[model samples]
Target: MKKLAITCALLSGMVVSQVWADAASDLKSRLDKVSSFHASFTQKVTDGSGNAVQDGQGDLWVKRPNLFNWHMTQPDESVLVSDGKTLWFYNPFVEQATATWLKDATSNTPFMLIARNQSSDWQQYNIKQNGDDFVLTPKSGQRQPQAVHDQRRSGRHYPSVQRRRAG
Candidate 1:
């Protein structure tokens, strides 16, 4: 009984610390001056059946007010670009590109508000620092259920950004 009580107390303490470690608010404050940023990282895509269909590394660039360029160079090759107004999906094998409105299109899209510091309605996210990078997950209070459903169908995935090694 005593061992069980101690284990329960330890688990509770860990949970509280995890919640307190989220750094979402701090990141939001720094975003004002962040005109453009870039990074290179690996992405693992899992389907609804929990199967890994794709895994690769890529370079990502983002400019304020919703502009992003993602170029995948390994495993498979593809390019996704968003120029604030239109989003483009370019396939090298098909030699074709499809364009759509940034707001209307959805998928396991990396550029969703999951990348932003706010919710779909522009409310700030619940942030947590997971090791070297920060994870920004939405709060239920601000996230609309309908939007969440729509995003799920589109396969929206937002893992925290991983830091790059210094050269």
Candidate 2:
């Protein structure tokens, strides 16, 4: 009886771990194939006080090797578009447009991380499919890397790799 119970426990653990690994690998596969893709999504940004401050719908465009453009059209007119080297943010409410180097920006922000196709294993974070959505939980303070490449092959700027589907 004792041996049977131990074997059952070990098997259960393997099942759970396999499930998690499969989910991660699936997500990675999606990222690996994303050369230029578009997705529409709604995001609810909450504050530290636990109040929902803003909600909006946006479309994402990613053209690899490393170019991404994101525009939020609902709830307000705001935009964040990155040309693989520089990121631009235009907020109509503030009547301001700010630009910064991609290397200095926050790469770990949820939307940016996903749009840029940053996929790491559960050792750095956990990824699970919640229904049709993939819920990614970052482990502690691990920051996602920003893959910023140059436009041309000059060696000074890392050229963004745009993965094209084979004909």
RMSD of each: 10.6, 11.1
Encode model 1's per-residue lDDT on 64-99: one tens digit a residue. 667888898888788989887798999898899999
Model 1 spans > 4 angstroms off: 1-22, 45-54, 106-110, 113-126, 137-167
The top-ranked prediction according to TM-score is 2
lDDT of 1 at 87: 88
TM-score against truth, every candidate: 0.55, 0.63
For residues 1-167, what per-residue lDDT tens digits would candidate 2 score against the true structure?
99999999999999877877786676555555555666565655555344556667877677764577778899987898888788899998999999999767845444443445554333554556533345555565554321222222332221222111111
Clash count for each candidate, listed in order shown = 5, 8
Candidate 1 Cα deviation (angstroms), residue 73: 1.2
Clashing pairs for predicted structure model 2, backbone only: 64-161, 64-162, 65-160, 65-161, 65-162, 149-158, 150-158, 150-159
- lDDT winner: 2
lDDT, candidate 1, residue 127?
53
